[model samples]
Target: MAPPGCPAVAPVGKWKVIGHLQLLCLLALAQPGGPAWPCPALCQCFGNMTVFCSEEGLRNIPEEIPPSTTQLFFVETALASVPSRAFTNIAGSSHLTTLAFLGSSLEALGEAAFAGLPALRVLEISTSQLTALPGEALHGLTNLSTLSVKFSPIETLETGLFNSTPRLETLHLQGNEMESLPSDIFHPLRSLKTLTLSQNHLAELPGEVLAPLGSLQVLKLSDNNLTCLPPGFFLPLVQLQELFLDGNALMELPPGAFSRLTSLKGLHLQHNALRGLLPSVFAAQTNLTSLYLDNNRLTELPERLFHGTPSLSVLSVANNQLQALPARLFRKSPCLTLIVLSHNRLSRLPAGVFQGLPALTKLLLSHNNLTALPRDAFANLTSLEVLDLAHNQLATLPEGIFDSNIILFNVALKSNPWACDCHLAHMADWLQHTDALLNLQTLCRSPAYLKGLSLPTVKKEQLVCLPGPGSSRCRAEGLEPSGEPGTLPQCTYQDPVGAIHLACDPDACQQLSLHLPGQHFSENWTLGSGCGTVRVHITVHIEQDKAQPGGEAVLP
Candidate 1:
């Protein structure tokens, strides 16, 4: 999530993202006739009571921060430490609502460093060398609301650190080295809403640590070593909506573990060591919508696991060791849209397994051991769009298997050992007419004569039934299209490092437009009428729903 006043855009690389915000500031101290707001030496002051200071050499805070200043950002500076009464110069300045220190080497913070700022609300000390924050450091900010000390080396948080800030709402302490926390440390934050404690070494949390934040909504504890959750650990977060407990070492969840999170919506338990889950574990998450149980050691899921979550939308159990799934597993989650069951050990799917998911659009069954699917398995998915059945052991699809998916546009049948015989004539004829797109490399892997032929480019006459009695089978294969205009469209994908390598045909068009399938809007760029590749980092956003993890996709 972005800082208090920042727009909702993800940071790139890490702490350096904050430096990008500096580019929006007027480089000059004060625009020629912008505003009279005092521009402290070594700082750029804007008309909107904001000051940005980013320069090396001088140590300590700038001599002065205009008393009328509302937001102050310090990035890539050599200034270090905030001695006692460090902000005494701006004491009692209620208009100063935000103070952030990014990419700095400030290691020490005096006990009374922020002594008397009455109305200060947001304080972010990110990506610094600070090892600890004194208990009384935030002594007099009575109305403070957001406190972010993230991406620092802070090892521990003092017990009474928040004794003075009663109105605090958001606390982000992720990316630290803290192993444990004081039980009553959060006993005073009655209005706290979002707390992110991810990327830490915490193996366990005190039962009462989060008992005070009844108003808390989002709690992210991902990338930790939490092996288990003590009973009642989440009983206090009655209003919590989203919980991220992924990337942990949890092995099992007792029945009724989350029976009290009635208002919960998103539950992420991916990348853990869970061996199994009880059907009642999520019995009370009636409002749940997203559940990520992928990348685990599970072998099976309870048949009625989701019997209570009727509003469930996104469910991912990919990358597991399952051999089979109970056919009625999703009988209650009628709102499901995205289901990722790839990278599993399953060899078969029970008929009617996906019968009632009218809202499902994307189904990933790739990298599995399945050889065939029940003919009507997808008969009820009227709204299905993207289906990935690649890298499986299937040789042929049942006739009319995909006839019900009228709006489906993308199907992945690559890496499968297709027979390219009578049964495959349906898929070949469908590919020749329908608008559905498949991988260009989808090949036939049977009948020695046409072993490596691309399925999409095969002639319908060559898909006749195998030789019988005196009949003979032969190959009249068609060549794969040259992917030029009027042929196959270019496809682009995002690499693991988040760079889009776009290939444009300078001679074909003057502008390049990218429209990600399923996205309400598109990203367009002009290639400047030149040639060569341009690599740039990207921050993904979706017009609807939470931005899902990045992956490969074909662009038209």
Candidate 2:
């Protein structure tokens, strides 16, 4: 028991002893060297080690951190700039592996700002207003492996900006305003494997700028303003596997431009101003698997353009001005699976144009000036599935154009000047019979007639027919149907079928012909006879097959 003025001390049990020990431990932790600090309302503590001051209205980094704190995250704050000596005090702590300022209002980074991070492996400061990067900003990040500064306003990067980070494996500077890179900007990154600089304004690249990246596997420079490429521009990237140059202003590629890139598997050069391709432009790249050359100004291709690339699976040359193609253009590429030649000026196709490609699956030849097609045009294309011949001048097609291709699915022949003649009789039959094939709104535009009429709806009787005996003819007296005269009696027929069908024996027909005015034989004339009389003689011969089975049948 204690005195009257003092508080009484109760008898201690196990629980009371434990409570006193915890109080002593808390008091020890509350010292200057402990984890306790003047944390803000949005901060939390984890036993003497780390502080998470996330989502706070902090304008800058806190002045002081607990001495034992090994990691700090000031995420989504109102930080505008990381001032000098910001992380100088944290050099004494060796356990900090990450320091992220993600989703903050950080606008700029001063010189030597990040020189204190020694063990930092990743620094993600994306979605910032960083217009320019200081040369020495990321100098001390020696062990950094990944750095992503995407979606920034970085217009220019000074030389030696990445001189210190040698072990960097992945660097993403995409969605920036970098128009050009210094010649030696990437000299120190010897171990880099993946580099993405796409979605920028880089018009041209110095030859030596990309010559040092020996171990690079993927290089994406798409969506830029590159007008042309220098010779041997990409000759140094030996290990590059995928190169994307799509959506650029590349008018032409110099010969042997991609000769040194032996390991390149996929090359995208789509959407450019390439007027044509030289025969040997892609001569050296034999290992290419996919090549995209769509949306160019290629008028035609040389016979041996794809002579060496046997592994090419896809070749898209759509939206060009190609009027014709050589017979053996695709003779060497047997592995070509897809070919798109739509939106061209091909009025006719030579025979055996696609004879060599056996594995082709999809063929697009729509929107051309083709007026007719040969019978065996698609003879060798056995594996074809989708054939597009829409929007052309195909007036007629020969029979069995799609005979060899049993697996044909879609045949688009719409918007063509299909002549509704006897030549299209089989097509009309197929349109009504073939249920598996697609017969789009094909109309006719030929024979100086049958225009503005649907092919499916036109009747068979309206189609043109060859001249025969039943066709209208005109002849004169003593003249045969061929306008030849004879000594024997002869009669001419005028507007033969326009009158009516008549049947008579040769002897009986001559009697009726003598009743005309110009004949010498006279007849018992009927009443109200005309003053003038003409006589005409006719002859006829019946075929042996026209006789009845038993004997000759009498004429009516």
Candidate 1 vs. true structure, TM-score: 0.79
Best candidate per TM-score, number?
A: 1
lDDT of 2 by residue, 1-556 (tens): 2222222222326644443224434543463445355554565545555555555477866656555665566556788998664676643334555566656688888776766667777777766778888787886788888888777788988889898889898888888899998999999988888888988999998878887789998888888999988888888788888898888999988888888888877889888888988898778667776888888888888778888676676788888899999998888787777888899899999988888777778899999898888788888787887888988888888977888887775677788878776678777766664443355467777543356667777555445433344432222124212222332222222222212111122222221211122223122221111211223333333354542322211111
- In the range 1-556, model 1's lDDT, one tens digit per residue, is 2222212211226443433354547442354444475566677777647777787764767666666677778887887887787776752245787888888888888887876566678998989998887898888878889999999999989988998888999999999999999999999899999999999999999988999999999999999999999888898899999999999999987666687889888899999999998877888887887889999999999998899888777889999999999999888877788899999999999999998787888999999999999899899787888899999999999999988888876888899999987689888877875443556778988744356889888655455454344322111112122334443233222223322223333223211122234433223221211222233222333333434433222122
RMSD of candidates 1 onward, in order: 17.1, 20.4
lDDT score, candidate 2: 0.68
Pull out the clashing pairs in model 2.
490-537, 491-537, 516-534, 517-533, 517-534, 518-533, 518-534, 518-535, 519-535
Please tell me which predicted candidate would have the highest lDDT against the true structure. Answer: 1
Question: What's the lDDT for residue 182 in model 2?
Answer: 92
lDDT of all the models against the reference? 0.75, 0.68
